[model samples]
Target: AQTVTQSQPEMSVQEAETVTLSCTYDTSESDYYLFWYKQPPSRQMILVIRQEAYKQQNATENRFSVNFQKAAKSFSLKISDSQLGDAAMYFCAYRNINNAGNMLTFGGGTRLMVKP
Candidate 1:
């Protein structure tokens, strides 16, 4: 069985600053994909970034990036130049590449509060 863990239930950051949210997972499969999804007040799950287990370089999208430590099964999300619009519930998800159904195993989300 695979499981994702987010130790911090909630976090806050000042506008324009950087914030890092921690995520760890346990999995026996070698081929899998990790993701960070942001769900704002609108309740839409937005894909923030993704990292493949075979990739050595961390995945980045604009001000959003991931520090993927495969050896430790740690995938953390870094949000730079934080803005008020960035405030949302961020979820860490996992999916095995071999699964045909493509089910996602999500972690207990971390709520990010951006303060002005």
Candidate 2:
């Protein structure tokens, strides 16, 4: 079974500063998808970024990017120039490459607190 792990249970960042969240996973499949999701106080799950295992280049969206290490099965998210709105619970999710219609298996989640 594939599993996702987030070493940090909670994290804090000053407004306008950057922070990186650590995540690692164990998967037997060579091709799969890794994702970072953000859940705010509202509890809505939002996709922060996604990286395909087959892609060598990392994925970036706005102020978010990932360091995907397929060999090590490590996928981390970096939040650059963070803002107050960035405060949320960040989760690492895994999806099978072959199962397109299946839902994602998520990590416990890392709660991000933004201080002004």
Candidate 3:
């Protein structure tokens, strides 16, 4: 079983600036995947980035990046050059590598507000 936590229910960032959203997770499995997902007003979930538990390097996608700390069980997302399109509900999730259904355990999402 896995449990993820997003301490900040909401976070605000200025346009063109940078913002970091915090996430912590608990998992008994040694091999798993950690991810950051973005859901806009349309409710479509988009994969922001992914980190493998065995990998030490952080995951980065374009303007999005993650600070993944395996020991601390932390996976925080850092949005660089924030834009209006980046405003959305961000979720931290995870799943065992061998999951059959690929079902993901998600954290209580954090709403990101981009201020112009």
TM-score winner among the candidates?
1
For lDDT, candidate 1 versus 3, the one ahead is 1
Candidate 3, 34-74: lDDT as tens digits: 99999999999999999999999998999999999888999
For each candidate, what TM-score against the reference? 0.99, 0.96, 0.97
C-alpha lDDT (0 to 100) for residue 52 of candidate 1? 97
Pitting candidate 2 against candidate 3, the one with the higher lDDT is: 3
Two-way TM-score contest, 2 vs 3, winner: 3
Cα displacement (angstroms), candidate 2, residue 106, comes to: 0.8
Model 1 pairs in collision: none
Q: Which residue pairs clash in candidate 2?
A: none
For lDDT, the strongest prediction is 1
Every candidate's lDDT = 0.97, 0.92, 0.94
For model 1 the local lDDT of residue 73 reads 97
Per-residue CA lDDT of candidate 1, range 1-116, in tens?
89999999999999999999999999999889999999999999999999999999999999999999998999999999999999999999999999799999999999999999
Q: What lDDT tens digits, residue by residue, belong to model 2 across residues 1-116?
A: 88899999999999888899999998889999999999999998888899999999999998999999889999999998888999999999999998768788888899999899
